[model samples]
Target: MVGDYQTLKNIIEQSLLTALFQPIYDTEQAQLYGYEALIRGPSNSPLHSPIALFDSAVEHGLLSELELICRQVSIETFAKLGLQGKLFLNVSPMVFLQDDHPKGATLSFLEQYGVAPEKVVIELSERYVVNDPELLAQALLYYRELGFKVAIDDLGSGYAGLKLWSEILPDFVKVDRHFISNIDKDSVKREFVKSILALGANINSKVILEGIETEQEFYQLQELGASLGQGYLLGRPELLPVKILPSVLTTHQRKVKYGNYLDKLASSVFQHAVSFDSQTKTGAIVDYFTQHKHLHSLPIVRDQIPVGMALREEVLELFASPYGRALHEKKPIIDMLSSQPVVVEADTKLDEVAKLVTSVHDEQLLWHFIITEQGRYIGIGSVRDLLKQLTEQQLQQASYANPLTQLPGNVPIYQKIDDLLTKQQAFHFAYFDLNNFKPFNDVYGYAKGDSVIRVLADILQSYCTAEDFIGHIGGDDFIAIFVSDNWQQKADSICQHFDQAIRSYYTQEDLNQGGIVSPSRSGELQKYPILSVAVAVVEPDVERCRSHHDIAELASSAKKEAKKRCKELGKSAVYLCQRRGPDGL
Candidate 1:
C-alpha cells in the first residue's frame, strides 16, 4: 500500500501513527477494568487501517521498526490521557527475537510516562505465532521478570492453542469473538465456550470475551460467567479519554448477594502442630513442650503415621506428682501416650472435628485431635484452637447478618463468593428485588412495606436448603446462592409463589384495577403497578471471576434485565444470563 521501503521507514522514523483506546469492563464490578491500545496509521493515507499498515511494513522488511514505533506511541499517548487502569499493548512474538528489538525500551517509556510496570499487560496476538517456543518463553520470562503482566490474544483461533497455553501460563486469555456472537442461540458454541472456561479455570487464567456487538451476546456471556468483556456494545475504540456509559453505570453497581459458606478444615486452621517419633524420650518431649507453651498436645508418630496423642494436662499432671519426674523422665514418650487418642483425617471438616472433641465424656481425655494425610501423621489440632475458630466464625456470621430479616448480609455474601471462586466451584448468583416497591412503600407506609419484605424473605428461605445461602441486601432486595442442580425449579417456584401471594397485599378494587393511582415524582398523578418480584440469575465462569466483585457486577446486570421484563409484563420475571459449555453440540 505504501510507495516503497523508504516511505515505510520514513513513517516509522517520523512516528506517523497514533493510539486509539478501547475499554475492557469488569462484568461484576461494572467498572472500567483497563484500556487496550490499538495503533492506527495516518488518517488520509492508504495505511490508515492497522491491517493494511502492518501488511505494508511486512512487505518492506520494516515490521519490527513499525511495531516498536507503535509501542512507543501507544505508551506516550496512554500516559498523556492519564488513564486510570492497566494499558494492554499488543506485541508480536517475532519482535522479541529481532537483533535490533528495543530491549528495555518499554521500561524506559514507562518511566518517561510515569506508568507503573504492574499497570501494563503485554498482549501477544496469535497472528504472529512463535516459531521457536523456547525463544518466546525466554522473552516472556524476561518481560515477567521486569514486572509486566502477560496475556494471550485471539486464543482459540490461533496456532498457539492449548500447547502454548500450557508451556507459558499467561495471566489472561482473550477468547476470539466467533464463539461469542449469537451464543444465546448456538448450543455447540456454548459448549465450546464452556470447555474453554473450564480450561481457563484449570490453569487459573482470566479469559476476556471480545468482539461482542449486541445486547443478547453481552448478557449471554455475562450469564455464562464471563467477568471481563470488551466489545462494541460495551465500548468502542476512540481517541478520547475513557468515559463510562450510562448503561454501564446503571448495570454495574453491586448489591449484596448470597454465596455458599466455606467449610474450613482442621488442617487449614492449625499450622503449628508439633510431632515426635515414638522412640523420643519422655524427658525430651516434656522439655520440647515446656519450651513451646503454645502447644496444647503432642503427637507420637511411627513411619509418618500418628499412633497416639499426649494430653498436656495429663503429662503435666504426671510430672507434678511426687517423685513423678524421677520415675518416668527417661522412658520413651510412647509409654505415656493416651490409649484412645482421637485421630482425624486432614480433609475432615472443622465442624465434624469440633463434635469429636466435645463428645468426649471423660474430661481428662478431651485433648487435641491428631491430623493425618492419607493415614499418615501430619499435625495435631488443639481443642482450644478449634473452639476459637468456631467462635470467631460465629461472631463474623452474626456481624454480617441483616438484623431485620436475620439473613446473611454483604460481607458474608462476599466471603461465600470468594470461597467458591478459590475452590473453582460452579454456582449461580441470583439477585431478587421488588419492582414498584418504592411506590408501594410511599402509599402504604413503612409497616406494610416491612411486612412485604419479610414475606418475600420467608418465601426465599422456604425454598432454599441449608446448603444454599440466603441474604437480605436491605429493604426489598434479597439474594440466593444456589449450589444444587435443581436451582431452575427453585427459582420458578419462588417467582410463582411471590406472584400469587403479592395479590393479597392489595385491596379488591386495586387488584381489579391492576395497579394503584399514585403521585408521580413531578406531582402528576400516574398509575403504578403492584409490587412483584424479579430474579436475575448469573452463572459466573469460575475461571473468569477473580473475586466477589466480579460476580456482584454480573448479578447486578441480570437484575436490571429482570426488572425491565417485570415493567413490560406487569408480572414476576426470572431471567438467566446464558452461559455456553465446551462442547458446541
Candidate 2:
C-alpha cells in the first residue's frame, strides 16, 4: 500500500495523464467542431491506459483528485494550444459526488484559466453509479447552473442504457464504440444507431458517436444523423504540438491502405428477377425484362428450379432469326436460349462478376446475366443496363453534391428549403463563410483548401437533417436552412452542434494558427480570422412582400452582419438577425 501511494503520487505529480485529442467533426460542415479529451498514461508504465489510471485512482480513493487534475491539465493544454472549440472531459459519477467535493474550487480554477463551464463538457462515465435519482439530478442541476454541460458516456455500451438516458436527461450522449466500429457491415447496428439518434433528437441532446475509424463508418453515421464523431479515422489522439494533417502523396497512400468500402455494387441499384416454367413463351420473358429497367433478363425454370437464363439478346435474335414467327407464336423461350447458362449467387465475389463478364465477352452473343440465391433465380443484372443506370446515377449524384464540400449540392438544398417555404413555415438560415479563405488557399495549395472544404461539408452534413437543407455555394461559403416554428431555438441547437464539431476536427496547430499555417500567400505568413458562422431567421411571409430570392438575399445580408462582428471582435458569439416577413402588419 505504501508503494502504491508513492507510485500514484509520482504519476499525478509528473502529469502522467497525457491527452489525445480525437477530432469531433460536424457531418454537415465537415469541420473540426470540438474534441474529446482522452487521457493517456505514461509509455511503458502500468498506468499507461486511461482506464487503468482512472480505475487505479478510484481504487486508491483518489477519484476526485485524479479527475480534477485531468480537468486542469486538459484546460491548460487546450489554452496553450489555442483551441477554440469545446473540450469533452470524462468524469466518473463517484467523483461528482465525493464527500470532500471541490466543485467550487474546480470551477474557479477553470475560470482563472479562461475556460468557462459552457466550453467544458463533463462526460458522465457510468464507471460508478448513483443509486438515488434525486441525488444525481441535484448534481446535474448544480453543474447546469454553473453553465457546465453533462453527457452520458458509453451510451448503449451496457444493459439498460435507454433507462440511464431517461433518468439522467443529459445534455449529450456519447454512443458506445461497439456500435460505431462495424456500423457499415451490420444492418442491425445501423438501425440501432438510427434509433438512438432519434431518441437524442426527441430530448434535444447532442449525439457524439465514438470510435469511428473508417470512411464507411463515417458515411454511415453521417447519414444516420450522428451530430459529432470521435475516432482514429478523423484524427488520432496525440499530445500537443498538434499538426494539421497534410495533403501529400503519402497521405493519399495511407488512406488507400486503411480505406473502407461500402458494397461492391452501389447500394442504390434497383433490380428484381422472376422465374417461369420452361414451357413459358418467349414473349412473356421479353415483357418481364422490358417492364423492369433494372431486370435485364428472366430465368427459365423447371420444377421450381432455375434451368437456364433466357438472355435478352437471345430473344432479340429470335425476332430477327428465320424462326422469328415462333417468337410471337407457340414456341417456348427456353427452346431458343442456351440450356446450360452461367449462374451466380447473390453472395458471389465481385471478382466472380468480373470473370463472368470477361467469359461472356468471348461468346458470339452478349446479354444480361442471371443472379441467384442458392441456385434459385433472384435477379438479373445486365452489364449494359448497369453501365447506363450507374452512369446516370453518378451524374445525378455529382449535381446534387456540393462541388466544394462534396455534400448534397444545391439541388436537394433548394428542394428542402422549398418544402418549408411552401408550407409558410418559419425557419433559420445559418450562413457560413471562411474569412481569409482565399488567402489560405493561395498559401497552402488548393489541396489544403480542399481539405478545409471537406471538413466544413462533413460538419454540416452530420449535424443537420434531410429536412434541414445544407448547401455549399462554392469557396468557403455554406448555407443551412433549418425549418422550425421556433427558428431561434433551432438555430441555437444547430450552432452548438456546429461549434463542437469544428473544435474537434482540427489539431492544436491548426487552431493556434488562427486556421492559417506555415504556408504563406505571396511569401507572407497566412492569417485568418476565427472560423465562425452567422445566422438569420426568415419567418413566414403572410403579407407576400418578398420573393424567395429576396428572403435569401436578406438572410445573406444578415450573415454579413455576423461576419463583421467576427472580424471586429475576434470572439465566438451567436449573432441572430431577423427579417420581419410580410406577416408584420
Using lDDT as the measure, which candidate wins?
A: 1
Q: What lDDT would each prediction earn against the true structure?
A: 0.80, 0.65
Question: Which stretches of candidate 1 lie above 4 Å from their native place?
Answer: 1-3, 245-249, 252-585
lDDT, candidate 2, 479-553, per-residue tens: 777664454555555455545555554567877766755445467664565455555444435346344565566
Name the best candidate (by TM-score): 2
* lDDT score for candidate 2 against the true structure: 0.65
TM-score per model over all chains: 0.46, 0.51
Model 1 compared with the native: what TM-score?
Answer: 0.46
Question: What is the alpha-carbon lDDT of model 1 when measured against the actual structure?
Answer: 0.80
